[model samples]
Target: MQDRPTPGQHWPITTWQGWQHFATTPPPTAPQPGEPPRSTEERLAYHSAFVTVRTPAINTLATQVRTLMLLGRHQQTTARPSLIVTGPAAAGKTTALLEVGRTCHLAHTRKHPAPPGLAHQQVPVAYLLVPPGATAKTLATQFARYLGIPTTTRMTQTQITQAVCHTYTTAGVRLVLIDEIHRLNPRTTTGAEAAGLLKDLTERIKATFVYTGIDVAATPLFTGAAPNSPAAPASSPAAPSPPATARPDPSPTSSPTWRTPSTSPTTHPTHSPATPPTSTNAPPAASEASPASSAKQPSPPSATAPNASPRKHSKPSSSTTSPKKQAAPAPANRPKRHDADVKKSADTPNDEDFAALYDRAWDILIFARAGYLDDVSAHYDEVLHEIAQRTEHTGSLGKTDIAALVVWKRLTAQTRWATDLMSLPDTHVRAVTEQAVTAVRDTTLPRSEAARTGRGIIAELPGLRTGDALASAVLTAAAPQRMAVYDRRVQHALDTLGLTLTPAPGRYGRYLQLLDDLLSHGAARADGWSARDIDTALYQMGANPHPAGT
Candidate 1:
């Protein structure tokens, strides 16, 4: 345990020693007014590390984590309450989480000095990222990796989990910090199980957990509330950045490195997205951010130092990199599923709604067909099954197949969509739909990301450009088992059931996650269920929701 990484070697932050270094190491010093980096390497190094901005939001988070840690320490049998920090991407959620971890690590070391030779062995904190398409096994392995536990390919998930819990406990880890919590889509089977695993760990380990992500409150991720263990968790919003302000600099700018700290705040405190009563499932829109560092470069360079002496040409050398960096920040938006907090909160669902539905998820699956428009709806499974076969064999759908789904989806939709898709030339529709189909079925991407990519590509087709109903249908048709259909009806049912599935972009992906969650809760009752099955149930729930007989 006393062993440390070789100097300058890439230390995995997931490991205990790596985290120990991060928690103890200080951020690089910013260039002073008179001291700018002289070379390209210096500029990159300066831009690489995120600036630590101590705003009111991060300070509050620190205090909350500390309080919860102390409270969890005394709890011998109960699951401790945890904290969730949600905000926009690039809005400092990651930065704040790290700062809080650093504070916790140093504070613990000062308060609980190891006695004699046991100094380095008393690990106090652990950190991990919720991976893209995180599974229970992957998550458990991450924990093992953080603690340097040896895991073989032969190890079962249960065995790995048992080892991790035992090791973390033995290490005296009191605080567990997980970043990118938004990646865990509780609606997906794997996401739901991963979420369940986390909840289980909270109960089993005597540690306080702090989760940070983009707008986690607004998505089904908030449905993280479980009855067996812990108290309810609390959330803190990220620091509000002021409007973007810029300063004039005569010096040549670095494409990637920092400019003077822009006086104007580029970001504001992102308010939690509120679900309107009418459209509870309108998920938040989001995009990925560049590196977390805040280095703002100066303006682009002038041509040949523009009418100046030849020697002055070198003065503005930093200008060349400016355009690339400036253009790079162009659209670092948030994800459609990067919602704010727990399912029970926000405008999506109420506790009563969940109590009524989550427990009887099986009833929804088995009985939804009876009340549903069976005459029309039954054709969906048959037709989709055939279409799915085609997609499986060909890797993309043809124009006729695409058109059939558009017609069927619109026909079943409560709100009939009028579109000119039928009139479009087969070649045009075929090209766009195929591109979308391929992106959605991409094996490499997380299903959520794949849905987003596919949606953007498919929206070029008629009718799909405006609403997701047709696009979702096509994507689901592309991979029936892997994807799910979404429309206002499904949204209505989810809202009624106290679940959140917004119509924000990339919603098709989120819809699958929502279905996965039901299947997860359904357990054995939902055996052999597909995301498509959940959509049918949602249709029924939205059509008529209430007590069984009444």
Candidate 2:
């Protein structure tokens, strides 16, 4: 018999069985001559593959949503309180909701065998997306379908609502998540009716409502502004009242140098030039001639005296100028004026308002490639470096270059289409590239015309559809500085910043303009970051389901 081949030997296989055995067996462990065990790149690539970067913003928001869900489950109330998760498009609102739903579902299933005598299984959470332009009837039907209730074409809205309530109560559902609520048009009559139906359900059902949407705060539903109901109070707390004695004198200018006596226990007698002392032996009343003469003698200059004081008070003015000169030198002796100005500006009411909004409304988590490298898995740094090295060979990215990136990234929702696009012939790929270049260069064309050109290119590609993500990706790549990617994530981010884009097919240009405005704003532009970088940050923040610092 032939001697068996050693583990590291590369002996020729003579039979099919030998070939199969060779294929199935693990690779030899022997190291090659002068070869190190594992390179830094290899190790980094390995770590980066498994690392999921989470931000503090995402964690806090998720925790808040989860806590609210749990509270709703155990609370005893006729009208269950609801939560609104509003943020920019693509900022992980749906992801966070789904995560909470999954946790609730798992907890429900773990108690698989209900306590003895409990006839039905409990569904701790129920989730559904609101269809675009959904009406009262459509919403009711959708809710019914989620509850596994059969619906007939003739079923009335009232009937469907009742069925949904009955099913939810029977299933013991404590939380209901409604996503894509931005699709619900409150301007329409049907939309108003649908909102009312949802409100009524909250009162009728024991389940708490958790809504996720892009700029949901702008909607009447979350704004706490029902038709005939009072508007919700502002999120800011009321400013505290000043101490009564510390309040400014009502007529500071009328009484020049009158000193107000302190009411404190440690009070001391005080005097001012404007007020004359009264003694026990002095006359109770002054003669009219004496008052006229006193009035003519110029009273002490008040603190509120005009910048150009009367010539008669020149003596006191000279004394005040000396103090002013002293303060000027003191300012010079102290820190830089600009630094003090910055501090004062930072503490302004406008800054405080922004801070409050950032704390409350801007709760969405943001992720960036650079951020991922900061104390993240050591492998990610190398991975990012590799990506940078590979892309460096490509000339400065233009429309076509960005198109290639989008294609490689597979920005489309349809996996199969992305795969087909990736595997397209070199000629077809070149054709798409040229089309992108032309679209970018044709600035004179109207937005609709440019969009038509983009759509035509998408149509040429097999299995591709003309949607916002695909179209916007092309334009954004073509002009990264002038344009932004218009998808759910971008929309959601804009919404979080208090800018709501109308969801219309013809509003693509408007969306682009709004994104440009945001990037151009003084505060946003102060960091000197590029539009593409900002877009990436927005995408990461919007897409992170699990925030790090919860």
Scored by lDDT, the top model is 1
Question: Candidate 1: where are CA atoms >4 Å away?
Answer: 30-40, 114-119, 223-550
Compose the digit string of candidate 2's lDDT tens values, residues 493-528: 445444455654444555544333333333532233
Best by TM-score: 1
Clashes of 2: 16
Q: Supply the TM-score for candidate 1.
A: 0.46
What are the Cα lDDT values of the candidates?
Answer: 0.55, 0.42
Evaluate residue 99 in candidate 1 and report its C-alpha lDDT on the 0 to 100 scale.
75
Candidate 1 Cα deviation (angstroms), residue 540:
14
